[model samples]
Target: MFNLSYKAQRYLILFGFLTIPVVLSLMFSYYPAFSLLYYSFTDWTGLGWEMHWVGFANYKEVFTRPEIFSVFEHNAYYFVGGLIQTAVALFFAVILTGKLKGRNVFRAMLFLPYVLHSVAIVIMFKNVYHSEYGSLNLFLQSIGLGSWQQEWLGNPHLVNVSLAFISVWKFFGLSMVIFIGALQSIPADLYEAAKIDGASGWQAFRFITVPSIRSVIEMMMILTLTGALEAFDIPYIMMLGANGTDTFVSKTVDMAFKFQQAGLASAMAVVLLLIVMFFIFIQRKLLFRGGE
Candidate 1:
């Protein structure tokens, strides 16, 4: 019998533990992915078995199409909204991580929204944003600022923004939680050292806090961008992709189920994946790994 090398034997043992999960993932994730990729090149209307190979036609139509382009525009609204959410969350995190009364309570309150169901949030906010007798309008009227009241979910111009706001309110807590973890992990010695050198509050924050938490900030930025790009639930539940609040994922789902254009939708999905991958590549190269 032949004896395997020590490294080869170790690798065999490692593969024994990893094999099942790796196989399962390949079967479920990668298999579906490759199938979707192949189907994107075909005219496979989800209902039928007559999948005609149409080579790049689906891809061409996806870009050359304008309705889908409008969908992409909607995604931009969510992306900007997510960035705003991240900024707000970061501010809250910075405050909460510092010396303050009831920091734990405040953290729990901020993080509460993230754990709530999207359906519940959508239903609750739907009333909150109602144009006529909604809580928002009522408050504005009572506060002597009625002119600021506008149709939050009705007006097409504001619908996306309104939806974006709800999305931000619901998920900003996640970013806050991440920021808190990163901030707390930072060494206290650095701040003390800076203070001993007569560093001002702004200087300590700028030089020490910012530099220490920079990686976390970068990670959050990527997460926020990706989350915004793929935004769906709040917009979908509230607007159903109507009034120009359709995101790419929502639109793709609509195509597959509502329009039954599975092939085209698959093609759209592939394009979106490519776009997301492109952004990730750019960020990894330009932002994260720029120093190396």
Candidate 2:
């Protein structure tokens, strides 16, 4: 060690610290990922080693079927729902950051659900959406809006929207928190300067608030896009992916576990991964490249 240069000593220590994580990552992450890719080309029931190569058959099935493609459409509903959630969150964040009474309490109340378990939330909403005795139907009856109430979960047409609402309720708080942080990072003097220039509230918000937080909004869009595409849990738990509520990830799980078709599930997974990666690439090029 005494004979080694100072830079060499630092490099050696850094290599020692990275060794465990690098080895673990290769064993756990990379190994399973490559295995999934390989499994996509084979006929495996996920229960045995005796499997035969069946290249592209599963991929062909995934791309050809309308029922499977409907899951992709459901994913788009989730994405649109997230955009609505983002807009609502942004509105709340903007108001909360302004000089208003009890804003902290309001923020805390709004953010409460973001910290709750998603499964628990899903279970709770499952009951809330019940057609017969659910709170939603009961409330509508109380308000003389009984005609407006329909089967929130039972019907195929309303199931996706109902589930999407649940997702928005769960996630908007998180979006609000992210927007709050982004709003705080914006310079107060900009608003002050705008006000001095006789800017209206709407004008300041449109020009200053929106433009300044462009990057954060772009980040949220990417996140929501990916999250919506990969949505599984709430729909799975609430509807078991039934009645137009099935999404890409939920369908993948059903295929792999319920039907014991690991090869087809792997193909679905690979296709979904490619779609997500392609969107990420587009967002990176347009929104994130060469800048913070």
TM-score of each: 0.93, 0.93
The local distance difference test score of each candidate is 0.88, 0.90
Error of 1 at 255 (Å): 1.2
lDDT tens per residue, model 1, 162-195: 8888888888889899988988898999989988
Q: Report the lDDT of model 2 for residue 39.
A: 96
lDDT of 2: 0.90
Show model 2 residue runs off by greater than 4 Å. Answer: 1-9, 284-292
Model 1 vs. true fold: TM:
0.93
Instruction: Summing lDDT over every window of 10 consecutive residues in candidate 2, give the lowest-scoring window.
Output: 283-292
TM-score for candidate 2, please give it: 0.93
lDDT of 1: 0.88
Model 2 per-residue lDDT tens digits across residues 27-74: 999999999999999989999797899989999999998778777888
